[model samples]
Target: MKKLFTSYLDTFKGLSKEIWWLALITLVNRAGAMVIPFLSLYLRDDLGFSLSSVGWVMTCFGFGSLFGSWLGGILSDKLGYYKTILLSLIATGIGFLGLQFITSFWAVCLGFFALITVADMSRPAFFVALSAYSKPENKTRSLTLIRLAINLGFSAGPALGGIIIASIGYYGLFLADGITCILAGFLLIQTLNPKKAKEVDQEQLVENPLAPHKDGLYVIFLIALALFGVVFVQYFSTVPVYYKEVRLLTESQIGLLLGMNGLMIFVFEMPLIAYMERRGWNLIGNVIGGLLLTGLSFLFFYIEGWPGVLVLGMATATLGEMVAFPFGNAFALRRAKLGRQGAYMGLYSMSFSLAHIFGHNSGMQLVNSLGYNLTWAIMGLITLLALALLFYVKRRANTLKI
Candidate 1:
């Protein structure tokens, strides 16, 4: 028994110190991820935003995220990963402080847009840092490690956010969230210190955006990914709001239901992925299957007559999330040569960034106009279209030969 435990531990043993530090930073920052999970709810419950307005207002975050994704990649390459991470964190912390004071709708929307843009710049820079420290073969696992850290933190954030709002109000949550970001950035900077200064001050800095490579696999994947993202992202945006409105679940209940994704991922994903790889699981197959399951997950909302429909639906969605993301990151990086990782990671982040605009806005609009089940059914269909695209790309997956 002890040998088995030790062996499992060994699987995570060899990587870089940098990878571990990045995961630590992820844990600290994401532990305070109290804002976004509650953003839609805040708009609706506090400011009395109609569902349509909620959707449109959330569009600001998406637009900001799009620019943030681009900037994260670019700055990580040009200015260095450390500086990019530092600037993103400290700047976003200020944004959150600004958010605490906004009361009106347009003001709230603009605040969210600006805040998300600044905060999201951390994503690709974090990815670039991960790739720098990961061995080629372990890249997917490396990505999964940071994601695991994120999930572990998320497992706490929603539940904690629920408590904070109950005790201290949304204002407290925002201030807490802002403080953690600054703290995480500070800790990360101090830990890496002068050694991390290499990217900016040394030979590794990219002076120009590298041109896109041949065969356009990167571009194709990005387009297909955006489609899948439009479906996948509903868990964060539409799910809580829908359940709260229609199902009449309380904030704590909604948080737990949402946080279930985190708990399951934290416990199960690494071991499960390890087992699958040993059995020769195809990455693209997982991607396609995950997308299919994501669509199907929404169908549970139709089965409201059953007791566990919502929980079951969320369970299915979490599984889809687990399989898709790390593999997607891996696929994105698989085609890139050594130095261009920042560019690839940046563009990959952009896929979801763009999806946020389409998904949140269209999803809430559908909910307001067409109703939840119909909106979900439409999303399921879109997922199938995305699956078809992935299937096409899978056949030529090896063509990326970079």
Candidate 2:
């Protein structure tokens, strides 16, 4: 175990301060995100809210995220990433603290929206900073390191959050989240020591607004990603209610099952991404593979009384994510114009926001109307359609290559 741990530590030795800062921020940010896996539980079990109402809170959060990501991209260039990161963390900390004291539905809804804005706004800036930090050749590896750290935090967070909620309740969990966020903010502020107003302007003057590779195929890739986002976002939105109602899992069991995704991501994501990097296969193919795996995984819900089967399905789906996410981001960054990388990535980030709003609203309605099993089955079908679109994009990329 010591030897294994040493190897993990070795990977960090060569990275620059910028990369380390990004990874640390990811860990800190996601520790706050720990609440999400259990938020639905809190709403339903603690607050006596309906699933549909829970969906509305999620939608409002998504709406705030959409605005936040847009603003982050635009402002990160103007204000610098360090300021954006620090401000976002402070805002998120306050929001979490507010959540601890306020239980009213409207007020909680407002808090959710505010927190989501702060959280989402920080994401683009973090990515932008990391991309700036790494050299071109090492970009994918650096990004993967960040993903691994975030998932590592996520892997520990939900299970820990579950225990906290089960033991001290949401207040304890909320306070811990708030505290960690403030620490993360301070760490970011001290580490980055960002430039003043004029330095940001000088950097912008030299950066090309449109330089990443421009092609129609990239747009097609983004569209396929948007569709996949719909199903992906449902895990936090409706899957909890489905597991509780249809599968007869308790809150703790649901938390365990959700944590399984983070565990798989934490364990397998880097190696899987590394292998895919070597495969030299067009990423569009891997995207389809990811969609198909995700679709198939949902089908495991049909297995009667098999919570373990659901675990395998989620693990498989995460495997797909490990592949698809990095590839898609790399593809977008490579294809985007240099100066507008933030803009394109920001728009790409919007797809996730849109998906959350659509997924939560639609998943709740569909589950209520069509039953949990059917709702999942339909989500599978949406993935299949996304797979088909990706297939088309692959052919288009191939033709262009030829």
Candidate 3:
């Protein structure tokens, strides 16, 4: 145990102070991520929208995310990540504060679209900032540290959100979300002085940087990423509803169950990533394994009636997430050319946005029509398809030597 603890600590060494500050800002912003986890529930129960309507609203959210990601990348490159991040956080905060006022279905859809567009604009900027802060040698670990902060906040957020929902109601959640985003913006201003920090030399990182759009192999990787995201995002989108309606779990129980994913990642992901990095494992192989595990996680839903299945599935999915996300992010970052990091990261973020666009609505529609078991089966099949594309990407990368 002592040796294991030491290894975990070792994983955190050598990351920049700026990365820590970035992680802190991420933690603060994500801790109020109470809204997304419970958005479907709020739409259905509080606003009295149909499940179909909820799905449509989520689809709009995805579109907004896609646009935001693209814009953020452009802005990061032009305005600098520091300014772009501040703009996103402050604007998103105000957007969230106004979101609660929209009650009608179409208005809610528009509200979410606008809100998410402003909110997700930070994602690419955040990635660019992270790349600027971290050294080449420690890039993966730095990514993991930021992810750790995100998961830790997610772990706390849902639990606290459940309590808030029980007491003051969903309005409280909106308030918390809005306030925290603004707070994070202010904190970033106070903490990270981009002018003073010694940025990693980009010229040394990539000798010949390829534009993300022009790179065929990277595009294939992005396709696979989108598919993986489709399966993975179900946890945030449809799985909560599944827990409540099918598994007969209460809000608090569901929150705890979802929180388990974050807690597990927080406890185990860093050391696991460190061990893999030390072994010099192939990034593509790690991602494939993670996607396979994630696919199998959904299959566990087949064993219905027992609440234990939910726990088991969450554990499997969390493990898959831990394995895939950091490495996948690292791969994207490494693949980026020095000058075009924003474009690369923007496209990467955009892939997940595509997943969000399709995944939520499709899962909900499947559940509404075909039943939960069939929906889980379909998600597994989708992952299989993603895996196939990834294999092709691996082959192409070898052929092109990218």
Q: Which is the leading candidate under TM-score?
A: 3
* Top lDDT prediction, candidate number: 3
Q: Against the hidden reference, what TM-scores do the models get?
A: 0.93, 0.90, 0.97
- Candidate 1 residue 253 C-alpha distance from true site, Å: 0.6
- In TM-score terms, candidate 2 sits at 0.90
Clashes of each: 0, 7, 0
Determine the C-alpha RMSD for candidate 2 after optimal superposition of all C-alphas.
3.5
Q: Is candidate 1 or candidate 3 better by TM-score?
A: 3
Ranking by lDDT: 3, 1, 2
Writing each residue's lDDT as its tens digit, candidate 2 over 238-327 gives: 877778887888777877777878778777776666666767777677778777777677777788865688787788778778878877
Which parts of model 1 are misplaced by more than 4 Å? 1-4, 194-210, 213-215, 398-402
lDDT of 2 at 126: 73
Q: Rate the local accuracy (lDDT) of all candidates.
A: 0.81, 0.75, 0.90
* Predicted candidate 3 versus true structure: per-residue lDDT over 254-274, tens digit per residue: 889989988999999999998
Deviation of model 1 at 61, angstroms: 0.5
| lDDT for model 3 | 0.90
What ranking emerges by TM-score with the best candidate at the front? Answer: 3, 1, 2
